[model samples]
Target: LKAGNMVGPRVYSTGTILYGADGDFKAVINSLDDARSSLRRLKAVGAFSVKSYNQPRREQRQQIIEAARELQMEVVPEGGSNYFNNMTMILDGHTGIEHNPPVWPVYKDVKALWNATRVGYTPTLIVSYGTQFGENYWYDRTEVWKNDHLLSFTPPSVIDSRSRRRTTAEYGDYGHIDIAKSVKYIADGGTKINLGSHGQLQGLGAHWELWMLAQGGMTPMQALRCATMNGAAYLGMDKEIGSLETGKLADMVVLNENPLDDIRNSESIKYVMVNGRMYDTDSMNEIGNREKPRLRFWWQMTRGGDMINLPVNNTETHLFGVQEGD
Candidate 1:
């Protein structure tokens, strides 16, 4: 990729390397050549990592993992709906898990696998459990989306959809308690836990994930660490942006309340600093008001705010893309 190649006003740069799979089944990588070809293409694009979309068979998965490992590429396996499938992925030693595997109750067997692997976990709780307004869920939970701060940066169209009613089948909550239990088990086990929103609602979605983690019994400190330090460590960028270290980038939020006391207190954002410059949080919210709504009022309400412009420290947000090999 060229240094000045621009997608809109933003310059594109090298970052994450994603390896898509055709289906949610094993035997996806049918041969060593197929596996190596994927690796070769990954290196050619300068991607430092790869994700197996629907996971291959145990042996196939191992071959893919070995190929990526030989070239020092991180392997993140995607776990869909099956819990046992996730267990096998962990046994194969992937670097991290993409979605929260259906690991409810987090039994002794699961703990054994986790203890043996100690891999990073990203439980995208929002997509798994966040309310879908279009489906008329969480309507009584006004505390979820009624905050002035959330509404401020949120588009008016989305704000208006809060009360709209629609009919759609939602994911059952049968596994919720177990999911939360597993989060507690894995986190307390000292495993690195990270928050994954899976596209719930942008900034608000992340906070909700944190809240879910806390509700799952993680202390505020532990949940914050999972969101910040653990995430940086997962991407091998801990030295660059996780903590308030003296040498790290000043990419941080100015919270009006101590998140340590309550995870929801994170929504009380006052200002955001990026690249040594400060931006008024209200001004950032105003930016949303001027932008046209991207979807129907009800549809927008059901999704995350992927388009929100909350700039930090003036640094260009790096695009997670494949880089040309050196």
Candidate 2:
């Protein structure tokens, strides 16, 4: 089947999935017949989920949910940080709500929604409310940018972008307390919260997400569950990937310290095994670290390795942009 930004019946009948469709991409399925026909067409071609981009009105969402249920398909809705849409999606029914909802005036009906339906929640804390914690808080943390494991894979430009950046506080709001408090509220009330870092900073982003979840009021175990089992269950992969069970895949991390004592310790990783293949995280740092014959740096390389002849370059140097001096 051809894949592209195809629209209309071909998108579903021929198996083209729309990743982000705001307000059902303006295709109104108002009647039951319209809903049934549309969803049945999708299911016939093996489409299982409908992704809404934070714009569907309550009735529209309800219709989508009803149609999905009748067809045994899942509706995964993203509310784009809008409080009303997020709450409505949760109430109306969904497989998961993407990212944390807006922080101000926390959603009070979350527990009711949880009791009513089996919806999953993904906070996507790192990109969504990470800056809300405070610019100074992130900047002052030595470990965020200094960790050898992170710096090994992270580009100097990415590090610079995240470092020393000012928050919206310049306009008078100095912090992200509301979002943090709301996160704590939802977790405490027993809603199934899942971890989502939005793919920022690669592997290191998950640790940052867990740390922020702890800051938001989750116990270390609860936050860890959000990172592990909750996410697996949401993706329908818990039977295989979430825990260290006998029949599950051998995927797990060996940490240097107990993350239960402090979530930040999650970053202190020693080894990671996926599908029974073990990786020395420290040794993985060396693979792309050097140019043997001549010294040319692609990105920041952690110091003190056997690649001695290769001179280390300044981490602040941008690879593409050049100024006056050589």
Candidate 3:
């Protein structure tokens, strides 16, 4: 896609999870050599960065970071909800922490320490740890399945199954709110907070992250900055794509409503532009600088016509903690 061989958003991936502990996707690094070699292989296969996931020992995690630095690649380590590990990652100079710290009501000392550092935070509140997930809050309150834009791109079966029969929780019980409050504190102290949806939903999940940021008392503008400039800077692409600056790439969303007025208005998108090509937000068809209709998805052409039923296995249900009806 980056090479212009396909029509899609620009993608930068870490390829696979690099593990230090025993688990499914294994790239176990028992030594510095193992860490170096594992990273080399990922980079060779076109990974822009690496996910240093739950490396058991401090030394092991440090080895991955060291190797990543040597390879001139960014290391985004998983938080794993461990306070010590997260703090150590900041001290050891990781590119960023992938998730929020599990502990809530973060104190001034911790916030001060984090604000003093250059490490970025990408609290994936949708699947946040130590609290009810933020995704559930939207599902309970909104008709997610009826979102036309979301349904146009995502499989209806997937959206309907997850959104129709939703999970309900008290507003105060939503853990992500407290997590966002801590994020706001650190952000106010100059820590760069980036928006991360954790793939809970596609287009709409990003907006959910923005709104949740506001729930922590951040103004609409501050939350918008987290979704835009902070994310670009975190990915080291600020110069090329963060804001609408001279010599920057022409990538921006044209919204019908100003997000500064109300954070939820962020989703009032009319058109999207990428690399100077404009697209209609409703149908995702190229409109300006080119005229092209999006190709029909395989599911759309099938006999079931967007109602395809995919079988869920016992393992998948157990792994995702899905109840029988859900």
Scored by TM-score, the top model is 3
Checking candidate 2 for backbone clashes, the offending pairs are 132-176
Candidate 1 accuracy as lDDT: 0.63
Where is the poorest 10-residue window by lDDT in model 3? 312-321
Question: What are the clash counts of all predictions, listed in order?
Answer: 11, 1, 0
The TM-score obtained by model 3 is 0.90
Regions of model 1 farther than 4 Å from truth: 1-28, 129-140, 143-146, 166-175, 285-326
Every candidate's CA RMSD: 11.1, 8.0, 6.5
Weakest ten-residue segment in model 2 by summed lDDT: 5-14
Those runs of model 2 whose alpha carbons end farther than 4 Å from true positions after fitting are 1-48, 105-110, 129-137, 164-175, 285-326
What's the best-to-worst order under lDDT? 3, 2, 1
Residue-level lDDT of model 3, residues 111-165, one tens digit each, is 8888878999999888888888889999998998778777667767788799999
Candidate 1 structure quality by residue, lDDT tens digits, 1-326 = 13423211111222333334553432347666677777777679777777776644666777888888788877777776667777878888888877777545667767767876768888776555322321132333444444555554555456446534433343453344357667789777667888766655656667777777876788889888988899889888889877899999766778889988777788788866554445456445222224322222222232353432433222122322355898
Q: Which ranges in model 3 have alpha carbons more than 4 Å from their true place?
A: 3-5, 304-326
User: Global lDDT of each model?
Assistant: 0.63, 0.63, 0.85
**TM-score of every candidate:** 0.73, 0.72, 0.90
State the local distance difference test value for candidate 3.
0.85
